[model samples]
Target: MNSALGSRQAAAAVVLLFSYNGLVIGAYAASIPSLTARFGLAPWQLSTLFVCMGLAAIASMQVSGRLSDRIGARRVSLAMIPILVAAILTIGLAPSLPMLFVAGILLGLGNGGIDVAMNAIGVQVEQHRPKPIMSFFHGMWSVGNLAGASMLVLLAPLFAPDPQPAVATTTSVAAVLGVVAFVVAWRITPETAVVTHTDSSGTRTPIPASAYLLGLMAIGFGLGEGTANDWSGLHVTQIAGVDPTTGALGYTCVVGFMVVIRLLGDQLVARFGRRAVTVFGGACSGVGYLVTALGSGLPVLLVGWSLVGLGIGMIAPQVYAVAGHTAGGRGLAVVVTFGYATFLISPALIGSLVATLGIQKTMFVPALLLFGLVFAARIMPGREDDVAPSAEAEASWTEPA
Candidate 1:
């Protein structure tokens, strides 16, 4: 096992990397209204663009898992920083819709690669620790969301006169943060602690049945998360009849609770166990969407969104953690890929619904998806007997600070 101090440093590096990734997404999210106005795109066109990104992400994730397994996650993760930074810069400089599509592809590729790599590292960290700490790492992601949102709130007024400057400035910040993330990535230990399934002849085995169910849960959770990240601000403005600034606040409220709950998630999972937490959290998220759909005022809508954050915050991390135990890096990739595939369809689905049924009614889609978790939660592996004893012992490796 790694020394206590080395383990702590590795954990910090992983959390910081997660935060940087969230900052990139959050900053782009805050700029969506500006992007819409600048491009003069209908909701469907925007959805199509998201589909482009999602397709690219899926492709990249398919390969990233194998690449991480071969090269070590630390190197693969550090290498993605440049690609991510370049993509962010390109998105800022894009002058046409076609250019935006090209930028989105690059962004998706970088994001997909980094996502698998970091989760692999996260699994490594979890194996050395005695408790569930994946949620705490995810909490840093929420913190990044808050930081990015706050930045937009402060900077939006200064750049409202022109969309280019707003995007340029935001992406510039992302670039700077990416540089910091690269530095942190360098500090991560090169070795991974991963559990692999092997037969007597030392051939790798197929993914377990439990992983498939976990992937399904991830897909449902992804729909809710994707909606919140992509459409929550618009929902507040279009459905609740609020100003853009106020709408941004509603999005902020959702992420704020997400940060709080995820920060405390380890204790919750330890106390209640994985199955109970998954079911309860899913139910809360369903209720939150219902409240938002029925809300007549901004205050009610914001409250509902807050609940949405609280409820959905820990699901992904828990799912990833379980995947980590079951299949290590490959499992993380498979589950995340399945989950993120919702992004491929969700934007277009929601956009079509918004065009016809309206945003309020369309919210039911995510609500239904989240509610599905009630049954799906049954598929997750229990804490006490999930990982094989030999795999656990073999997977532990020293990670230098």
Candidate 2:
């Protein structure tokens, strides 16, 4: 569908869309403990759930990127909304383990598609802007994550102590937010992704070498982000020996830090350049895991996770912006697929590792992996990349009229 929205309005609509995606994920993040209890899930079982979700999400990415290019990204993104809602609801309310697997697959599939489609939309929107705004768009996603997790935390006191009610309420909130996001996207999303000549010409723009490096960087960021959103609360309960309610604060702190840095990320990129930011963020988060590993108390845990959040907040938005600016959908697809593979897979991998290594020790894995960001930083884009598109990218797309 064609969009009639002016620039600011279209930007707002995409922001809401990105936020809604994060909101759904946040609801899942908030309900992790409750879902664990509601299903009497063992660590391995949780691993299985994540594996199912990760695999399906990975599968969806393989197709969704090309699909978005074939059709309008707006339509593809809007189509995934209800699927996402149903998946999140099922996750919070599934009666059996098998059904939970179903929920995981559904959620993964829906999320994977929307993730690619929305980024496509975001990149297209950024194409028209004078300054880098991709990071701000992603920052709103962090805000949405904070909102989702905080909503559950706040509502828990009002409900009975049952985990199921919290799960239900969290999903209900997601459902409402999902509806609002769907309406906004349907009415005014800019659908700016190129869909005509490139599709027919059989043109497949080769992804730049740098985009691959960015994808490599994205993996560590994805793993770190997954850990914060999925298991920070549990990390508090297990390592810090806090009550589960207080553990909720762990999730909030990490994502909350993410919100601050992401909102400021574009400016930092403008000032320091993506390579400097990537290297610094990598070092900070790697050390954060070390700090987390050493700390047995709440302050240390929160501080460590806060560092992780801040560092990671700087990584993904820049990666997305660079890839989207230089590579278009296909390159972005390669990057997104690699990036989010770690995003969802980290949860499953950690669930498995946490069983053997324990949560405290498992922190080292991301720490080690994230140090790769420093190595990958060599390929990060300069300040010029923020404002310039690759000639290859210019050939592959025609901005929708």
Off by over 4 Å in 2: 1-6, 42-44, 92-98, 195-203, 227-252, 290-303, 344-365, 392-395
Each model's lDDT comes to 0.77, 0.79
lDDT at residue 138 of model 1 (Cα atoms): 87
Q: For model 1, what is the alpha-carbon lDDT of residue 15?
A: 86
Tens digit per residue, CA lDDT, model 1, 76-173? 77777888888887787788889988988888998898898888777667766667778888898878866775676687679776766867788888
User: For model 2, how does the per-residue alpha-carbon lDDT over 88-144 read when each residue is reduced to its tens digit?
Assistant: 888877888898889889999998888888887787777677666777889998778
- The CA lDDT at 5 in model 2 is 30
Q: Each candidate's TM vs. the true structure?
A: 0.86, 0.84
Model 1 accuracy (lDDT, Cα)? 0.77
- The 10 consecutive residues of candidate 1 with the worst lDDT sum are 386-395
User: Highest lDDT: which candidate?
Assistant: 2
